[model samples]
Target: MTSTVLTFAVSALTFVLVSLTPGDAARAVLGRDATPEQYRQLRAQLGLDEPLAVQYWHWLVRAVHGDLGTALSTGQPVLRTLEQRLGPSLSLITGALVVSALLGVGLGVLSAVRGGAVGRALDLLSMLGLALPSFWLGLVLVAAFAVALPIFPASGYVPLTDSPWEWLRSLALPVLTLGIGGSATIAKQTRDAMLDEMGRDYIVLLRARGLPERSIVLRHALKNAAVPVVTVLGLLFVGLLSGSVLAETVYVVPGLGSTAVTATQAHDIPLIQGVALCFTVIVITVNLLVELLYGRLDPRSRG
Candidate 1:
């Protein structure tokens, strides 16, 4: 309970600091040529010129009533905008999580069990994935598969309602971009954890008892190995949140990353605040899920 409260307080503080960023959307969109009266008027209109505490209170009240207000730049309802775009981002995250968990854990187990050339190759592949930046990789993919070969569209988004297949195609490049690094990281964590677990006396005893090698290594061993893997998954939530910026822009996907960067450039306070809070909530929620996962995986953690 104490930890959860602390997390909420920390998140609130982070949101406050983010909201206090200098200059409003008007100032950013319009140059310094805008007069002082204009600035004051805009501030009053935004209610941003007020004390930080006051603005926070107003936001809290409005949020409780389920009104997030319109974005200053576009005049779009902030909540509606988030709802419109969340599907793409959510889909990408889901795919990355599922694929990374499977490939990483499977490859990691294979590498750990076989200390030969195949294992060496997997290690090198993992390093390559980690070293490669996601955005850069996205561009390379676009060039090869989209532009040069014309296999996919160069850049654009199609609404799922309009064409689900097209929307899926649009997401392919970004998924590979985020997934490459995420999956590689997962594989490495899994391999290291599994190897460490395998060396334990209990695992050795299971192997000695003439248990099926595959069953003992996978069913029994992977459960124990998940402790570190779950930790990585919690940390991966941050990567999924921030790393989407590049991929979103590269693919022109309507994810939070694109909107957040646009808000920053436009100096839209509410939009930026929305982005920050969204990511903060995601991270905290993922961490809580991981805590629950810990209890599920290791009964001792329930204590």
Candidate 2:
């Protein structure tokens, strides 16, 4: 319920901010030499001459019906454009999430279980992962894998319909770029959670009962430690799904993030609003899923 309200609030906020932002979308489209009269006519045609509240209300109504208005640049339906981009974005995000979850949880578990040089090294790597900027990491990956070794293709998106293998190959660098950053965050969270769980009295009790360390850690500690990690994973999943603009831009993928960037730069209000709303919906859905997971993780949270 709160997430739904937040979605609406964010959508309204996005609309207001975009509307208040300086620059005339009409003029941007018409370019310089467009006189005041030309701007007036264009604004009226685009319904921009209406009061801001009226404009927002109109947008809200259409938005509720899944009609996000038409893009001024392409004259295509905004929803249609988003629909076209959704698949590639989902594929990239899914791949990244899987990689992050596996690497992060595995490394974190190992780090917790082994408290020596190996653990220290994994901890250092996690720190580096957090410190590294995503865009720079993306560039480095491109240089090493795409340019130096000529492994994965440097840029461009391929549809699954064309070739499943090619589609997967195209996303390698972008996935790594997002996954590496996400894994760092997840790893840190997982490590902390595991450490906390390990120090609990119950863990000591279980150890005293002669249960093997592996069994105790895997069956007991991991389940309890997973709650917070699951929360972070939900957030990371949303971030990836909404499209990592930096990663997508670098990879030249026609994902939601890239489309939003182009629309915002072009001052395509309808397109921008549509994209922002879609992101809000995705976030709300993910958050709700996280809450559900919380109930499962800690039965006390159910009430």
Q: Pick by lDDT: which candidate is best?
A: 2
**lDDT agreement with native, every candidate:** 0.79, 0.88
Q: Give the top-scoring candidate (TM-score).
A: 2
Which lDDT tens digits does candidate 2 get at residues 121-192? 999998898899888899899999999999999999999999999998999999999999889888889989
Q: What lDDT score goes with residue 98 in model 2?
A: 91
Report residue 241 deviation for candidate 1 (angstroms): 0.4
* Full-model lDDT, candidate 2: 0.88
Q: For model 1, how does the per-residue alpha-carbon lDDT over 193-260 read when each residue is reduced to its tens digit?
A: 98998899998899889899889888888889999998997788677877778778877888888998
Clashes of 1: 0
The residue ranges of model 2 lying beyond 4 angstroms of the native Cα positions read: 33-38, 208-210, 239-243
